[model samples]
Target: MASSASSLTGGISAAEWDARVNLAAAYRLTALFGWDDLVFTHISARVPGPEHHFLINPYGMMFDEITASSLVKIDRDGRKVDDSPYDVNPAGFTIHSAIHAAREDAHCVMHTHSVNGVAVSAQEAGLLPLSQQSLGVLASLGQHDYEGIALNADEKPRLVRDLGHHTYLMLRNHGLLTVGATPADAFVAMYFFEAACMIQVRAQSGGGTLRPIPQPILDGIKQQIGQVTRGVTPGALVWPGLLRRLDRRNPGYAD
Candidate 1:
């Protein structure tokens, strides 16, 4: 195991090592939030290469136990690019690869089946801006109809079409996906996306009138996020705290 730890960064670029650590952390963080669907859903970080390589969770490992060395590197065609003990989740990564290939800037993509996110996705109306959380998501959101478990490679183009240039994607009757320039950015988006969905679910349980945020307010949310985050990326601002929390509990992911 120590040999594996030392080899985690072996033969990888400095940037790729950083991506692995952050990606592994995102997987653990997802588990910490109860968003991991037992290794079913995926979060992929694009490796720095012209072939559009990505690092994904080794199939069968629970998210909490995922470590940097265990992540599997694969090309966009779902073929492994490295020698690792685990196999790649080709079917699962199809969703991620489609997004990574279509969007050059989306270096990381996260998908989740958290109860609230899937519950809200089932609604016909989808996410409603009943709270500020919802409003923030509503400001930059897209939706895609489910296509039977993401097994069909034929569905890739349509999925990419639905996700065109959007950061947050609500997979109707499926789950939620968020794209980002980095793993931290993707995790932050998923955190807020899940929070907004959870809030919507809880608020709907009351069966009372739902008040939507004003349209004017919705239009200004990008600026609002900028202001609230002080012109710095919200992910960078909040990621250190998340890492600290992880260090207190499960620090092995960084290896």
Candidate 2:
């Protein structure tokens, strides 16, 4: 593992190596949580530098199988910037690139085609405020209409427009997206985003009237979250424990 880690980090800056480790952990954690859709979805992190290069999972590899060394580095155009042995799914990079190019704060962009996320995205009401988890996301959420398979570059402007300054994005009839200053931020944000969807789906299935959180309470969620997190990103507080969990469950992402 040490030898492999050295090989992957050989020429990259320490910042890039750190980004690679975090991004790889995000991928494995996605799979651990059953949020991965084969290799169809993507989680991308901007390479920390002046250039607009990014790291994304290698194409055709299961999310649980991705490691720091295997993630492919690519430019904003989805062109490979590093000579990685693995290929990337440019179509998967479409949403990620659009967000990254538009929002500097979006250091990591995570998209998931998880069952519950897609189910909620397909709903007409779209993420009803039936759960506490929904409140945090509703405070800063955006919705984008699906434009086929996301293979066309023409859809970029519209995607960026819909995602303007928001942390969570629901792709109508598709899935969910979340962006953050780091992979930890994005991963934890998606956790709440997907949790809300899961609760919504189950509640609807119970065939009972859903009690929505009151608007007055929902309006104050941002402040409430700030207090809860004490002005720190939620990920900053949560990531270390998450890494410990990952180490016990699915080790080797760093390699």
Clashes of each: 0, 0
What is the overall TM-score of model 1 with all chains considered together?
A: 0.96
**Cα lDDT of model 1 by residue, 1-255, tens digit:** 222757766677888888888999999999998998998999999998677789999898999999888888888888888887787776788898888889999999999988999999999999998888877788889999988878888999999998888889999999999999999999999989999998999998999988778889899989888989998777999999999999998889977
Q: Candidate 2 on 75-128: residue-level lDDT in tens?
A: 989999878667888788887888899999999999999999999999999998
Please tell me which predicted candidate would have the highest TM-score against the true structure. 2
Model 2 lDDT at residue 103: 97
Worst 10 residues of 2 by lDDT: 1-10
* C-alpha lDDT values of all predictions: 0.89, 0.92
